[model samples]
Target: MQSLQDALYNWLTIKVVCDVRPDDKAAVETRDFFEEILTAQHSVSNIETTKDDLMYYISYQQGEEIKKRRYPRELIEIMINQINQEPEKYKDYPID
Candidate 1:
């Protein structure tokens, strides 16, 4: 069975790639971008970095349970830029 992480990844990929008629896709993208940034930032601080295995020291484990990852500030900034460049993408979309 696929883990929540895998499912989320699939969802993200679908959300980013698909151009459906829904007005909420943009919001999802923006939210996802911000989430990625935050996760990266937290990950860098709380987790120790190693030259050998990048994902070896990961503290969060996933299985039947859900796990949140660390987002990076740079990622958030990038998403912000995306939103800024395309203002209409995520405008007035309902927050999930």
Candidate 2:
């Protein structure tokens, strides 16, 4: 506890206290739920990053309408560029 206090004194941080529970049927089947794909339209789920993972999204609300830009455009563009640059490498892949 003393070590934590000393470290916190030098840096800004959030100390969360909660009882951890497994996400069972109640968590997923209930009306309130967050999907594996974070691009879903309804709620924005808070996430904790612990590794080389990233999430990108854009949202806009216009009165009664909720406009969500679901695709990760920048990432998609990078993938497209890779495929364009090496068409022969991806030639064996099937088309939709």
Best by TM-score: 1
Extract clashing residue pairs from model 1. Answer: 37-71, 37-72, 38-71, 39-70, 39-71, 40-70, 40-71, 40-72, 41-71, 41-72
Highest lDDT: give the candidate number: 1
> On a 0 to 1 TM-score scale, where does candidate 1 land against the true structure?
0.26
Candidate 2 versus the native: TM-score? 0.25
Residue-level lDDT of model 2, residues 45-71, one tens digit each, is 433222123333334343455544333
Q: Write the per-residue lDDT of candidate 1 for residues 1-96, one digit (tens) a residue.
A: 444344344333333323232356555675366445435533212322122222211233233443444333343235445655787864645535
In candidate 1, which residue ranges exceed 4 Å CA deviation? 1-59, 63-72
Point out the worst 10-residue segment of candidate 2 by lDDT. Answer: 12-21
